[model samples]
Target chain A: MTNKRVYNFSAGPSQLPLEVLETARDQMLNYEGSGMSVMEMSHRSSTYQKIFDDTKATLKRLMNIPDNYKILFLHGGATQQFGAVALNLMDKGRADYVVTGNFSKKAAQEAAKFGDVHIAYDGKDNNYTHIPTQDELDIRDDIDYVHICQNNTIYGTEWNYVPDTKGAPLVADMSSDILSRPVDVSRYGVIYAGAQKNMGIAGLGVVIIREDLIKPHKENIQVLAEYDTMADKDSMYNTPPAYAIYVLGLVLKWVEKQGGLEEMEKRNIKKAALLQDYLDQSDFYIYETEKGSRSRMNVAFKTPNKDLDAKFVKESIEAGMTNLKGHRAVGGIRASIYNAMPYEGVEYLLQFMKKFEEENR
Target chain B: MTNKRVYNFSAGPSQLPLEVLETARDQMLNYEGSGMSVMEMSHRSSTYQKIFDDTKATLKRLMNIPDNYKILFLHGGATQQFGAVALNLMDKGRADYVVTGNFSKKAAQEAAKFGDVHIAYDGKDNNYTHIPTQDELDIRDDIDYVHICQNNTIYGTEWNYVPDTKGAPLVADMSSDILSRPVDVSRYGVIYAGAQKNMGIAGLGVVIIREDLIKPHKENIQVLAEYDTMADKDSMYNTPPAYAIYVLGLVLKWVEKQGGLEEMEKRNIKKAALLQDYLDQSDFYIYETEKGSRSRMNVAFKTPNKDLDAKFVKESIEAGMTNLKGHRAVGGIRASIYNAMPYEGVEYLLQFMKKFEEENR
Candidate 1:
């Protein structure tokens, strides 16, 4: 933790482990003495092939993915998957979506283009204040799949436990909280994440789906937009985001070194608890979401007054804590403590918050 | 040229300037004195916003793209555009495709799934030996657009001049040849290139489309698949590939410092002429394409036997010249001299080929 440097709270496209960034920088020009940048190497070359294989294997190991699942490294963020999911799976049948936040609602709307989309649960009525309770969910028996967002970055709410779909295929957009905890891969039919918040960079998305879920549609779909074609080609039908994949490999290795997902979950909880405990004790600041549903990664909070919230954000930036401002849609302050954020960063923030409270109060 | 360290001849996802790599490496830990990697900075941050703005501006200057043309930095490679173009423009009627190489054929095949697709001209019957002659073109005035691959990386062929489309909009997949030379920007409706070849890395695709071409679609389309939404949002409706865009800016700067597109065209011509002249003069090896239609970037040639082609590829790898093997469809040796390849690399390859020919003969 002593080696930990700056505290970055920017929400997606956030911090990567220092060690991973250092290793990638060293290998940028010459990857493993191949005398070519990973970007310059052919995807089929033994060097790049090994990197690709090892990266996928590492991700599988970290997540405890089943042998029946195929891990795909694809281009276009999770937004593209909204369309891909519709094209591949909808089949003009009914699909249910639990809209906990902005992303899930967007996904539901996109998926609606292909089939009958039912909003089984929506947190928008409550300003996305809490995760949908299991009893609140309205699963349709005729539905093809159930889609949900596991974590909401904008509102700082996360599902505390996976919903039991009673044998319905579960598909989750775990973009913001994927590697931060342990997940049972066998329980879900599909898990997709944009590699920005807890994974690697902004451009690539990681999709881990059951092989059986990608059956070809009866209605002809565009070949490139079909999941089966992409899965069959191992996501190499077209040129992939090679550099992002390479960096993601480094990040997976870093996660393994940090004692894998269980350890990551423990450390993340400790860090979140440190800040949440401080916020709970202080009447000077208010946690934005309900206590039970607060996100471990992104902590959204506000001061008693709007002017003070602005001042806190401004003074925090001046204090070397940048990007602490919240989403424009819900403005206050959001401190995103992603995988790379050390415990000290959170401690520093809590201390500053306490001092600022005393000074302003 | 003496100051140049080594010449790189990779086809796509090829070499980047050493200075750019060095600067990026130095800034991998921190960008613009910010205490975070560019990979870690949020897309919404002013720090990253500047980087994004500068990248778009540099690309515009390098291409002399008109203000009326909206430049979009997208993901999923040029392959995505095969579907995206169909989704955007194929509503009125069919599209005319000129199949000059593998990429154009794939584009046509993908578009066929969406709407009526007609192959106006195909060079496959001639083993892609030459670009189509003006008289051979099947121009259809009623077509929505004309699609052509400006340069065929696999077959080592390039269109020397834009096809005369009397009324229909001209669209080009310039994945292999963009920014290698100047073009009449006003003549084309859209010019898209995958960044791997001449722009930057594999993750980003640069699309320069006329603004009018992005008019709202009358039919239902996935929001993510809509060009108008992407253009209206400045390519940020979803998270983009940030590091790839950063590298593109560096390449754009390098192009500008080298006297822009006019100077680059002269350099490219000289490099192509040096190697093609050697291939023409030598009786021991045969050039794969016709004399007039040879590619200025990828130079494919063949010996009389398959074993010799394998030997050349193996020997060249040992000599620090890599990826010289041609596409498996074309069983021969190909030397891809993209913009990053210094003139001396071509000289080295010629020298090696001459020696190999003498020994084998």
Candidate 2:
């Protein structure tokens, strides 16, 4: 039935597992005999609260999140969290940011709204080709938190190691890389992510924050902006993205069935390497990203000739590949091999690339 | 196929037209020829962008929205907008709020986070049984905007008339009643709805603001909180709730097929009146709300005996009439007849109510 399905490579709002999609489709008509789609279920209803709680519990167990962290399913996406983290956390004074790419820089800019945002290091000169080493981080005592975009989706770079923020708390925007790999949740004060790429669908952001971090502060902050408002009411403080959270639960279960984050990571590594190794060896294709900084989830590449790059993206779509076109900022091609991408998907792309290279050459 | 389908009457996230649900189900596995769920499509892609554009266009044409208004499909629920509206507007340091019921009062409290909020009138003294009159309003020149929750879902009351804002730029939180009736876009400065009620689903909020209202804001505000940022980028500021928006587009299209908002209002009236008239005439039932202020969207009522209310709710579920229990604050039986609630569904509820009252008596 899915033979007509192409290997969708769109960044962020990318592919979900076929299993997740089917489950959602099945539930879309009448979820568990409720005689209504989950879309039509009240967030305040017990049925939806069960789904919400189960989703949080599954994510916690899968990630091995510590008891100290409170999982919050929030709206307004990750970019909104960039500002929210600053509003909620940067109460003391300054915050530090290691700018690796576009999103990180935006995070720093948003954080700067509340207080001083010191750019500890910047990789803009190198076109955000690599993640800065931990030694390069400038942690200060006055800094409330040190923020990092763990993975640069647009630039195709990943931070393989977490940065030590001295005694200060560490915060990471793991939107692209979340759930694809295991992490020591204790290492960060907050690990927030947009659930579209690896987890579920668009519209909702999952925020994992240390319980102590969700304290009362500035009265000027919006009510819904307060973590307590959501925490106290179990994300039903407002109408939650019930459908998004439902689909996320399905994806989280899919990840567990695929042997948890560790196994998914290993599979993702092999899938990424299959395409990366081929691109590295080919003269027709170029992967100019720094070796250590390459993202296992997203691989951006280009041809030596610009017109050939355009031709490759166009022809690739015709040959059962979709969303292979890179972000307009760095126009070339980007293959986002998220956890949902089957290893065979990379193989499909590799064959397409080789055939196109031979014909063009 | 729908023989087993129960009538859902949850306040928000209530009921959707079966046609819309079926269309969404058929397209769940694949959207158009994209070979992936709409959830998987990148918000930036031309494919999803088309969906977004068509949604906005459909809503605008259906509402007869003037060119002066910018319709924003934003993240966060109506609750989030309570704060966002204050941050984006309330520039002059104060906004007047008429405390009609729970949601409007919450909106006033959230707005107060940014600026001073003057309670023009409070309906709590009467348990929000009726909306405060415009003559009771104390709109001041210093007020940035006068806010009102047009329809009270819990209290089962709706403002039968728009408040004379005295040129303070009227802003209405039209969450429950939006799209069930025609709204004169030019009557108010801004009209925002949570979309779960009458529009589509949860996880998305729609704001129709006069174009001039999308102005530059304070540097301290979050980018997504800024209306200009969304209006300039067509609400793709942060990937949006694309799936939610897609579903919303479907709902909007469904509304259009039902002969637009005018026809929807007529149908909703009949649906609400069917239940209300029966309840009003029944010796076992009590419709305590003021006749003039009653909501066509939500009708809250009660029986002479408290235990009977519980018994009726319990039995109604067995008979496939679910979610009929009223909001705890309004503790009795509440029937929310949004546009999606067919007259037959209300008929089923009426039969159940009559049978329950007879047996209990």
Best by DockQ: 2
Per-residue alpha-carbon lDDT of candidate 2 for residues A1-361, written as tens digits (9 for 90 to 100): 2437778988979888999888887877788877778888878878888898898899999999999899998887798799889988876778999999889999998888889889999998899998888787777787789999999988999999887788789999999999989999999999999888988888888999999888775788766567877788777777788888998899999999989999988998899899889988898888889999999989999877889889988998888888888889998999999998898889999998899889987
Per-model clash counts, in order, read: 0, 0
Candidate 1 lDDT over residue span A48-127, tens digit each = 88999999999999999999999998888788788677667775478899998889999998888788889999887889
lDDT of each: 0.86, 0.87
Candidate that scores best on lDDT: 2
Model 1: what TM-score?
0.97
Residue A63's lDDT within candidate 2 is 98
Interface RMSD list for the candidates: 4.7, 2.6
The digit string of per-residue lDDT tens for model 2 on B24-78 reads 8888778887888888998888888899899999999999999989999888879
What lDDT tens digits, residue by residue, belong to model 1 across residues B119-173?
9999978999899988889987688898999999999999998888768889999
